[model samples]
Target: MAATALAGVALVGALVAVALGTYGRSHTPTGRPLALVIGFTDMAPMKAWLATAGVLLGLAQVLSAAWMWGRLPIRREAPHWLGQAHRWCGSLAFVLTLPVAYHCLWSLGFGTDSPRTVLHSVFGCAFYGVFASKMLALRTKRLPGWLLPAAGGLLFALLVGAWATASLWYFTQPGVPLK
Candidate 1:
């Protein structure tokens, strides 16, 4: 049963990755940011800021997961609200990534001109795949205890990598409008 659950999750994740990669690679990029969630004058800074916020919330998710799993160094039992906090933070963080992803995929597509862009594209695609896997793992019954944590950690890492390649890079670039 556990193996079946694991396989189902893996299949979903792989399908998502392949579908996203195919669409991103086949679609011609507009070479401009899309008006997916327009309200800001400059989207570069806005996307970067949003990714930063998501990363911060993801960090909280990691910490809360550690506490719940008894892996925290503090050696204390997780509080009653810790699980709820983790779920809320994780949901919010995932929601925050949607607009940035929309702009990237709809406008930029899967870039390959530079190593950073290529890596970022891969990470961006993989993040959603891993997120799906993690969500499934949460609902799947009779799965190994390690599966959820592994999926979550990978999701967080991919988010960080994507943010580093895009958001962090954008923030550090000269002449970028910070407002």
Candidate 2:
């Protein structure tokens, strides 16, 4: 089951990678996000690196989620392999996430300018940190209890908040009128 879960994640990741790679290479104007497109193309090496990393990390995370959902009952039977897959996914996810997060925050204006940027940055960091802690806890056999829930809550809340900011961008009251 765990193998199936990992395989599923790998497949999804591969699919997503193909998409990301194509977009990353081309930077077509897909209306969903100019930022993602521009980000993938503008920086050359970094952008390409990030695009690949994004797919890999995404696969790791997806596999972990699928595995946990017990979608692959065989994975449950092989606890060691399951644990390994989860750990590998989590570790790789953390590493790959940094680049993408940094790309969003630093390369894009999502870090300083946009209202949504704040939530995106803060929550992203929190999510990564919490994920790291989870990895550590699992490895050491001592989870600090509050970390996982807090991380999950923060990630979701921040996502909603960021979405709100994006949705409300046009309606926000002007601080200073145009000259």
Candidate 3:
């Protein structure tokens, strides 16, 4: 069953990558750049902020999942609120990614000018793919219990990679311009 679930995830991920790869590069300038994070002169700072928020929320999801699964050091059974926290944090982290994803898809499409950029683009596509798999897993019944955590862990790892490739890289460049 786990094999089948994993296969499904791989298929979904490949489809997402192909679909994203097919998008033609936009000739027009990037639209609504930082509209979601208003007042930024440049999109870099806004992207950094959103990515950072995503990382933090993703970590929250991880910790909450640990607690909910009784993997934490706590002696009691999983608390109801812990599950709610996991859901809310995961949802918000996904939401925070929207503006950045919009900008990337709308403005840049995909690029391979550099290794980092390529990794970012590929991982960006895979991130959504894994996210879809995770969502599907959440709705699925009869799958092994391990699948949810696996999906969530994969999602979190992808987000971290994406964040490191883009936001962290942006910060390392000279000036670290907010505008």
Candidate 2, residues 1-179, lDDT tens digits: the string is 54454344335434543443334334433323224433333333343354345445555555555566565555444354666776575566456545554454443433434556555445444444444434343334333444444444443353334333432342344652211
Instruction: Give the Cα error of residue 46 in candidate 2, in Å.
Output: 6.5
Give the alpha carbon lDDT tens digit for every residue of 1-179 in model 3: 76786677667767766676556243443544545657776787888888889999999999888887777898988876777787899899999998887788777767577999888887787888788877877776667877778878988998999999999999889888854
After superposition on all CA atoms, what RMSD does each candidate show versus the true structure? 1.5, 14.4, 2.7
lDDT for 53 in candidate 2 is 52
Better of 1 and 3 by lDDT: 1
Residue-wise C-alpha lDDT for candidate 1, range 1-179, written one tens digit per residue: 77888899999998897788788889998878666535555888789988999999999999999999888888668999999999999999999999999888888899898999999999999999888888888888899978888888899999999999999999899888875
lDDT of 3 at 60: 95
Query: What local distance difference test score does each model get?
Result: 0.89, 0.44, 0.80
| RMSD in Å for model 2 | 14.4
TM-scores, one per candidate: 0.94, 0.41, 0.86
Give the Å error, residue 125, model 1: 0.3
lDDT-wise, the better of 1 and 2 is 1
lDDT of 2: 0.44
TM-score-best of 1 and 2:
1
Show where candidate 1 strays beyond 4 Å.
Answer: 36-39
